[model samples]
Target: MSDRIDKSLTRKKLDKTLKPHWVWAIALGSSIGWASFVMPATWMGEAGPLGVILGLTLGALLMIVISISYGVLIRNYPVSGGEFAYAFLGLSRLHAYISGWFLTLGYICIVALNATAFSLMLKFIFPNFIEQVKVYEIAGWEVYLTEILLATILIGIFTVLNIRGTTISGRMQFIFVAILIVGVLTITIGMTSSAETSFSNLTPLFTPEISALAAILTIVAIAPFAYVGFDNVPQAAEEFKFSSKKALTLIVLAILFAAAIYSLMILATGVAAPWQEISQANHAWGTGFVVQEVLGTGGLIVLATALTMGIFTGLNGFLISSSRVLFAMSRGKVLPKAFSNLHSRYNTPYFALIFAAVIAIIAPWFGREVLGWVVDMSSVGVSIAFFYTTYTAYKLLKWSEQDEGYNPELHIVSPGKKVVTLLGMIASVSFLVLLLYPESPAALGMESIVALLVWIAIGAIFYMIRRKELAKYTREELAYLILGKDQFKLKKEEE
Candidate 1:
C-alpha cells in the first residue's frame, strides 16, 4: 500500500508552465461568457439600466474584496487546492474537505452551465437547423434530444482538450479571450456609430418595479456566477510561473476587466435598444438581437462566432480548475485516489477531467431552464467556499502575528487586512442568504435546493468512507502518507 501511494505521488505531479498572462486569460475566459452577452438585457428587465449598473458595480466591489482575500491567502499558501488548502491550514481537515467539496461542485456546475449555454446559443443562431424533438419533461421544462446531443458533443470535445494538458487549454483560452475582447469592441463601436441608436433610448434608466437595494442584492446573488473564474488562478497556483504577488495581481486585473466588460455591455445594450423592446425579446439571445439591430446580419454572424469561442474558453477554464480541485482532494486522501491519476504524457488530472465532463454531458438532458437552477445552486456553493476562504485568511493573519518566527516579507499580514477579510466573509454569507430569499430575482427553485442537498449528502457519505481509511494515521502521518517523500522533497526544492 505504501509503495502504491508513493508511486502515485511521483507519477501524478502537475506541470508548471502557465505564465501571468495565461493565468489572466483563464480567469477572464472563465468569467465572461455567452451569459455576459445577454445578461445585460436580463438585468435591465429586472431593474432597468441604472439598476443594472448599480447592481453590477456593487457586486464587482464585493468581488474585489473577495479577490483580495484570495490573493492574500494564495500568497501565504501557494498550492493547487486553493480554498481547500487555506481551510486546511487555518481550520481543520474536515473544514478543508467541505471547502474543497463545495468548490468542486461549483466548478462542475459551471462546466455544465456553459455546456447548456453553448447548446442554447446554437439554437439561437440556427433555429431552423437544430430542431427540437421533445424527449420528455422535467420540472415543467421540455427536454429536447437535439439540445442534449449538442451539449454532450461540446462536453466531449472540451474534455479531450483538457485531458491533453493545461498548456493546450491555456493557449485556447488566450485565443478565445482575444476574440471575445474584439467582439465587445465591435459591439461598442457599432452601437455608438449607429444613427438609429440614441441616448434617448436609455430614458427611464431607473425603474421602480423593485427597490434599488433589492435590485443590487439580486445582482449580488448572481454575481458569483458571473465572477466565478477569477479564483481559478489560485486553484492552479502550483502551475504558475510567477511570484504569488504577480499571480494575485493578475486575478484582481481579471476581475476588473470582467466588471468593465459587463458594465459596458449593459450600457451599450441600453443605448442601442429601448428597454421595453429588449425586455419583450427572447432574453436568452438578447445580446445577439442587439447586435443584429446595430450591425445587421454581418454583425450577428461575427458576434455568434465570437460568443461560440467564449463558451469554449469558459468550458475549458472550468474543466481545468475543477480537475485541479479534485486532484488536490485525492492527494489529501479526502477523495478516492483514482481521481488523482494524471495522463502519462500530458501530466494532467485525466480522470477528474473525465468525471467533470460526464456531469456536463448529463446536465443538458434536463433542459435549458435547469441551467438557471444550476447557476443559482452553483452560486451558493461558491459562496460557501468564499466564506471559508475569507474566514481562513483572517485566522491565518491573526496566527501569523502571534508567531515569533513570522516574517512580514514571506506572509501578507496587515492591521486592516482582518477587517477586509471579515467583510469578505460577511459579503459571501449575504450572497448565500440572498440566493435563498424567495422574492429575490436570483432565488433558487425547490428543485435546485433539493439538488444541492443531494450533492451534500453524497459528499458526506464519501467523507465517512474516506475517514475510515485515514483514521489509522495521524495528521502529519496522513499528510506524508499521501505526498510521498520524493514529491515532498521536490516541492521543498522548488520552494
Candidate 2:
C-alpha cells in the first residue's frame, strides 16, 4: 500500500485548483437538487409549514454539530476520503473500510436518485412527451421506458463530465447553483407578491393530528439525505487551493446555506400552494404545481430548467466525491488498486467514476418507487457513517489529549467539541433507528432492507477475502498510504 502511494505520487495527483468558494459550490450543488423541491411536500404534509420549519431548524442544528466535528477532522487530515480517512486515522482499517462502504453506498444512491429525479422533473414539465411508453409496473407504480432511458443517458453524461476533470465539474456546479439560487429567489418573491397566494394559507401551520416531536423527528430522520453533500468538501480536501480554516469555514457556510435553501423551498411551497392540494398531490411534482400557480407556465419552465441544472450539479458533485472515496479506499488496500487509478490527463478517478455510473444506469430500471426505497436505505447508511465519524472524532480528541507529541495547533479537539461529537453520534444513531421503524416516513421496507443487507453482505465477503492482504500493512503504513509520506512527515514535525 505504501509503495503504491509512493509510485502514484510520481505519476499524478488530484488537482489543487479548487478555491474555498468552489468548495461551497460543490457542497451547495450536491445538495439543493430535486430533493429540495420535492421533499418539502412530504414534510409539509406530515406537519404544516410551521412544523416543517421547526423540523428543518432542529435538523440544521444537529447537522451543524456534525459539520463542526467534520471541520476539525478535515483540518487535521485534509484528505480525500472524508469519514473513511478519519476512521482509518482515529480507529482501525476495518472500521475505515466499513465507513467507506456505507458512505460509498450513500453517494451511489444519491447519483441514482438524482438521475431519476431529473427524469421526473422532465415528466412534470412535459407530461405528454413520454407518457405513452410504459415499461412495467412495480408496487402499483407504472415504470416508463422513456424515463429509464433518460436516467441512463443522464448518468452517462455525468460520468463523462466527471471523468473529464474536477475543474470542469466544479465550474459546472457553480453555474448551476447560481441558476438554482436565482430561480428560488425569484419564485419566492413572485409567490409573496401574488394575490393568489395568501398569508392565510399558512394558517394551522402545525399539523393538527401529529405531535411536534414526531413531526420534527420525521424530518430529522431524512435530514441526512438532504444534507449529505456538504461533507463532499472533505472528500475533495486534497484538491482544495486554500487554507484549512477557509475550507472549514466554507463547509460550515455550505451547511447553513443548504439548510436555508431547503427551509425557504418549503416555505415557498406552503405559501404558493394550498396545503391540502400539496398534501394530496404527488409529492414529486408538488413544488412544480406551486410554481405553476404562483408564476404561471413560464415560471414553471424556468424553475424546471434551474432544477435540471441542479440535477447536473448534484450528479457531478457526488461523482467527484464518491470516486475520491473509492480512490482513497483502494489506496488504503481495502479495495482493488485499479479503483485508485487516475486518468493521465484529467487527474480524476476515471475507473471509480465509471463503476458508480454503471450502478446509476442500472438502478432506474427498478422503477422510481423502488429507488425511493433505495434512497431511504442510503440515508440509513449515511447516518451510520456519520455516527462512526463522530465517534472517531471523540476518540481522537481523547487520544490527542494523552499523546505527548500532540499539537493543538494541528488538531482542534477540545472537550466541548468532544461533547458536540458525542451528541452528533446520538443523533445519528437515533435517526438510523428511526429510519428502520416500519411506520416512519422514510422507513426501509422488506425489499429495501433485503437489498441493503445484500449490499453489506457483499462488502463483508470482499473484506474477508482481502483481510489477510490488508492486514499486511501496519497502522503507520496505512497512515502513509492515505496521507502520503510528505504529509506524514509534516505531522511528525508538527507534533
Alpha-carbon TM-score of each model against the true structure: 0.90, 0.91
Q: Cα lDDT of model 1 overall?
A: 0.77
lDDT of 2 at 93: 82
Q: What is the lDDT of residue 154 in candidate 2?
A: 85
Write model 1 residue lDDT over 1-495, tens digit each, in one string.
Answer: 343233333434688878778889999989887677757787787878777777777887898888878888777566787887766655667887888888987888788777777767777778765667879988777677887788888889989988887778788889889888888888777787789788787767666677777766677777888888988988888787778778768887888888888887787788877876887776658877877878899988777776787788788888888989998888777888889888888888899999988877777777767766766677788888888888877765644466755555434557588788889999998898788878767788897897788878998998888888755444543344333222221111110
- Give the 10-residue window scoring lowest on summed lDDT in candidate 2: 486-495
TM-score of 2: 0.91
Off by over 4 Å in 2: 1-12, 398-413, 437-443, 485-495
RMSD of each: 4.3, 3.6
lDDT value, residue 326 of candidate 2: 92
Off by over 4 Å in 1: 1-12, 399-412, 437-442, 478-495
Model 2 scores a C-alpha lDDT of 0.79
By lDDT, the best candidate is: 2
Given candidate 2, what's the lDDT at residue 112? 87
